[model samples]
Target: MAIDPKELRRCLGHFTTGVTVITCQGEDGTPHGATVNAFTAVSLEPPLVLVSLDRRSRLCGLLEARAFTVNVLESAQKDLALHFAGRPNQEVRWAADSACGAPRLDGTLAHISCTPWQAYDGGDHVLYVGEVQQFHIHEGRPLLFHSGQFHHLGGDHNPLLWDDSADGPDAGVSFISTLAGTRRV
Candidate 1:
């Protein structure tokens, strides 16, 4: 089916995601980063993570068999995000270069360092898998994005929402329907 790109983007944007800056060194040994939200934890046994980059992105070209860092942005780091996303900011805070030789931004919520694990063609994008080497989590609220805008947490964290709910994903569809007072026809 021929899908409208705009419509597809809109639909996809409904899903909220955390913002991150994928950092790596250029061929000249200079630090570089790209603002990306297309990142996820892929596995546990071998500690893998994934980031999808546009095929045309300079960072995509630089990631082949390279080491990189994923800097998870906190709510106050929107300007940093904008900077890596191609909008120049007056200043960016750079942490000490990571073990992987990639620069990390200071004041981020988390930093995940990785070495190139695998790569796959993802149509307009390239899926890059990284074998996690090190990770650090800091205390801060994550920067979130949805529907073309940035968002903050509502400060409502219900730890029991899933653990104590019969309608949770672990309960199966029937339990969800029952909890909602609905039934299949």
Candidate 2:
């Protein structure tokens, strides 16, 4: 016999994911969005991303062979995430992306504008892959969700805090040291 669906869902919930609001316009150009945590980067060379949408969602139908924007939510914008998830909150901010004409929500940590590339059947969800047209990564921590709860970054170590790291910018392996000024590795 097949495993219990609830058990499978609980197992999947162990995988942490960043929150996103995938936005696209209707035939009449009306903006529409839905909170989607099932999103991931598919490729880097051509810059592609994939987002899974429920088969019955309205936005899912509109995205067929259409352009869209994926707004990776910041931790402070959790209410906006709830709004897109069908709980309509008080504050909703959106602006049109100049490159793709897709709606990108403000206060998001990052945004990716894309053109429809391909679609795959995913049992109960449609996996839509898009070719990235433009993207922006602003300064903010991304909103995260895991085990049905909202979460924030847990690590204290930031990789880019130093102006010059040995393996990063400096040639001949040089680094900016706090004690001695410049150290060569």
Candidate number with greatest TM-score? 1
lDDT of 2 at 2: 92
lDDT tens digits by residue: candidate 2, 45-67? 78999999999999999999889
Model 1 TM-score?
0.85
Off by over 4 Å in 1: 156-185
Give lDDT: candidate 1, residue 63: 90
TM-score of each: 0.85, 0.83
The collision pairs in model 1 are none
Candidate 1 displacement at residue 134 in angstroms:
0.6
Per-model C-alpha lDDT, please? 0.88, 0.87
- Pairs in clash, predicted candidate 2: none
